[model samples]
Target: MSLPNAVDYSIIICTYNPDRRLLERCLNAVSLLDTAGLVMEVILVDNNSSSALYTLDYVQFFLNAVPHSKLIVAREQGLSYARIAGIEASVGKYILFFDDDNEPDPEYVQVQKRLHAHYPHVAAWGPGNVNVDFIEGVDDKLAAYATEAFQDRHEVQIGYSNQRTWQGCYPFGTGLCIKREYFESYALLAAKGKFSLSDRKGNQLSSGGDVQMVLYCISTGAAAGVAPELKLTHIIPGKRTKIDYLKKLTYGTSVCYSTCLLEIFPDHLATIKSQMISERKFAFKVLKKYLMLFFDPRPKKALKLAAYIGAVAGDYIALNKPVPSGVLWVLKRLKAI
Candidate 1:
């Protein structure tokens, strides 16, 4: 595989007070032995983490092992803040975003080169993220990750199994990679204590910030594609793997998605809403799958599937609702929101 001769490729991760054990696995993956040739740096933005969970041993090891990585502490509240800080600090020509509770595949770094080589005009690429449902034993490095617990990948063109469509106007964050210039283009501006990306605060809670970025990218007519080769294992904690979490995730996804779609086109929302309502066939299909899982006899798998389908239902519900309540509430709540 021919890697890009470009100067920078920053792997930016935004993390909260993370599950230490899971984070350890991800840090290990990020600092793998074969990462030497990739022209990149790992920028872990600490989201106000007091101790900086990526420990000194982990930091020193990766700095020594991975070739390029720098740990900088950023005191910010949300994932968006951490990500933005990482972007501003990076010198990489391309930036790759990672969540804390993920273990990237060993072939991950190489995929960046492979994709860029194929489409020089393409601004972004999302990898195939295999979701790990649950891991047992607190400190066990060899925890189990169920491949069956995956989510929708929007790009199937590059062999990723995103459920949305072969070609997407937006992509997922787990495997999301973009040119550094693209990230820098949308810096948060402030005036008398206001910001340019200011409208995003309410949208972040509903989980559309990443999707919103992808939409912005695609709408601008920049080339975007999805590749399955760049991989990451998204770990699902015990709590997140429950029906209760599913309900919350579902509602949040719906609210967030609605907020994103409406933002991209203020006037076309009604048309989009109508079209979404017309796609009840797909929504029903999603619902039926969840109902069937209840009788499927596997507690773990059933619960996992339930959460996913519930999220879809929530999306449809938000679309069909006469008024978007949470959207308004969120706007009113966050001061800088």
Candidate 2:
């Protein structure tokens, strides 16, 4: 069948000084794909990252022969800025946003292109991960080559998109592709400027801009889904995979939840509360199983536990006040999360 513009897609990696060796490997993965002329180009938006200062000495060295675009030291420091810059510079029929830490499957570009071609009504899509593992320089082909994972019972995966495929809250940010027209069509209502919650100084420790962007697309008339066929091995740092890692990611993600739900699904807080209470009961059943790890695991575990506690509290807080940060302010603002 005819594909979406026969591979007229652009993949962008919003990086802040990605190490040269690692960056090269990531570039090669996408550049060497067998998409004929379909995988048009890649954009490496350097977010003022001086990781490989010498990389600029030879632009072709880092870009590695593909028809690519480069943004040297994006003035804004946040990931959102880098993403916004990439979207602005893209000339392709579809825009794919990949993380610097990700090593995309060879089929990544082709799969997304196929779906967009077939489902002309869909506005956007996300990537799939075979499993969660993070180790540098380790050859991870078996882990990198697939389209499914077996998850623990308690952790739970929410917001399934059978028609969209893949996992994670509807459409995830990593390996996510959005039609540029979504931005152009809804910019007046969608706020196509940088991410919504990102501070001027780039402190994204507690916000979710990617989710905000897609929610905006949904708010408008664009359809979004997941493409399980387009896979990637998300590099979860050792430190980030620990029990504590979940807490921070979840807590930081809380802000994204508030920002997205309020704008996209105003009744999301009620759902979270129902989930927290329901999931907590289920989580408690598994609590006995994980008790050994908590004898005094690490601050990460403590942080994760704190974040869950914060999330349960945050949910109710967000119900009234739409922002996530302080409990007192939430009480004052009448927000739950």
- Which ranges in model 2 have alpha carbons more than 4 Å from their true place? 1-7, 19-21, 50-60, 136-169, 185-195, 199-204, 242-246, 265-304, 310-337
| Number of the predicted model whose lDDT against the real structure is largest | 1
What tens-digit string does per-residue lDDT give for candidate 1 at 1-337? 2234565578887766667676777788877725556576778777777566557576567656655567776675666667788888877888888787778777877878777887777777776545453665221322221232235332334642222222443346776888776677644422232222222231243365676666556555666666666666777676654444443444444445544545544555665555553344554554465456558745445444434433443445445553233322322321112
lDDT of each: 0.57, 0.55
Per-candidate TM-scores read 0.68, 0.68
The alpha-carbon RMSD values of the candidates against the true structure, listed in the order shown, are 8.1, 7.9
Query: Clash totals for all models, in order?
Result: 3, 17
Q: Lowest lDDT 10-mer window, candidate 1?
A: 137-146
Q: Which portions of model 1 show Cα errors greater than 4 Å? A: 1-6, 54-65, 129-133, 137-170, 188-205, 272-337
